[model samples]
Target: MKIGVVSDTHLSDRREIRLPQELLGGLSGVELILHAGDWISPRVAEELEKLAPVEGIAGNNDGMDIVSRFGYKKIVEAAGVRIGLIHGDGYGKTTERRAFDAFEGQDVQAIVFGHSHIPYLERKAGILLFNPGSPTDKRRQLLYSYGIMEIREGEITAVHHYYASWD
Candidate 1:
């Protein structure tokens, strides 16, 4: 199964709050979509849903509505692989640390998170850590990015895809 992953899409950054073609166009061919949070508005997920099913958590920047819909953390299974998802917020020295700790004692092959708006993909202690970064709000990043997670016969393949602009 091929899954599209993204996070921290601060769509509210623009006055119109319209999604950029770069992002919408890029995530076109996936079976599922996972968002790690900080969507800022429910409209973000609503737009993504047009492409594929979306599952996500709520970030510190999200409002009550978003939290009510997705909560702060989640665990999902795809292709027989368990995946933990979080916003990478709350008490931890770094976003990565917070994300890593979120699923302690839980059985998960991968942890997907977002908060720092930095793209990351690595394997540590037999688990995959992936952050798709912010396609809308890049912060100091030179390029915007997102991620893809492919699972086949109990094997996981993860990667980050970078782009120059959101538009």
Candidate 2:
């Protein structure tokens, strides 16, 4: 199964800004999309659902409506693999550490998280850690980015897909 992962779309609070066309292009053909949150606008998920089925966790910047809708963490099972999802927003510990703690003792093979808008991929202790970064808000990063993950025969292959611009 091929999955598109994304996070930290800090769009406007009141006025809705359209998501990047390039993001949809990058996500094209994926069976599902996993959003790690900070999707400030509800429209973010709405727009993405047009491409494929969407699921997400809530972030620190997310309003109550969003928080209530998606909660703080999730576990997704697709094509015989389990993926844990979190926004990586808590008062203590590093983002990656927090992510690990969220699903401790769980049966997930991969954990997808975001809070720092920096792409990350690591394998530790039998789990794949992934952060898709922010396609709309790169902050100090040089380029906008997202991630793609493929699961085949009980193996996971994930890579960051960087773009020069989201427009």
Candidate 3:
């Protein structure tokens, strides 16, 4: 299964960041989409939903409706693999660790998260953790990016993607 993963689209009504039509258009063949949140408006969610089925959680920038219901750790199954998703924005100092730690005991094969707006993909303690970064606003750099994951036969085949604009 192919999955398009994105996060930290800090879009405001007046100033919004948009996914290139090519990007969404390219994802037409993907089986699912995962959003790590910071979607400022329901319109953003609605827009993404048009592309594919989305599994999303609220970020620090989202409202109560998202915050109250969205779980810090979400378990999903893709291509027979147990997957984990988290929006890694929290109150404590070790926010990322704190957020990820929420799924310590669960049976997850791959974990995806975002919040620092930086891309990361690595294996730690027998678990694969991935961060797609922010597709709109970027910190410590002047570019935007997101990610992709491909699963085959309950094993992650390849799970990383990034995109940015020069203009």
The root-mean-square deviation over C-alpha atoms between each candidate and the true structure, in angstroms, is 1.4, 1.2, 2.4
Superposed Cα deviation of residue 150, candidate 3 (Å): 0.8
The sequence of per-residue lDDT tens digits that candidate 3 reaches over residues 110-166 is 778788888777776777788877766778755667777888767784454445652
- Cα lDDT of model 1 by residue, 68-101, tens digit: 9999988999989999999998764788888998
* RMSD from true fold, candidate 1: 1.4
Off by over 4 Å in 2: none
Worst 10 residues of 1 by lDDT: 11-20
Global lDDT of model 1: 0.89
lDDT of each: 0.89, 0.91, 0.74
Between 1 and 2, whose lDDT is larger? Answer: 2
- Name the top lDDT candidate: 2
Model 2 lDDT per residue over 25-51, tens place = 889999999999999988888888998
Those runs of model 3 whose alpha carbons end farther than 4 Å from true positions after fitting are: 15-17, 91-96
**Per-model TM-score on C-alpha atoms:** 0.95, 0.95, 0.85
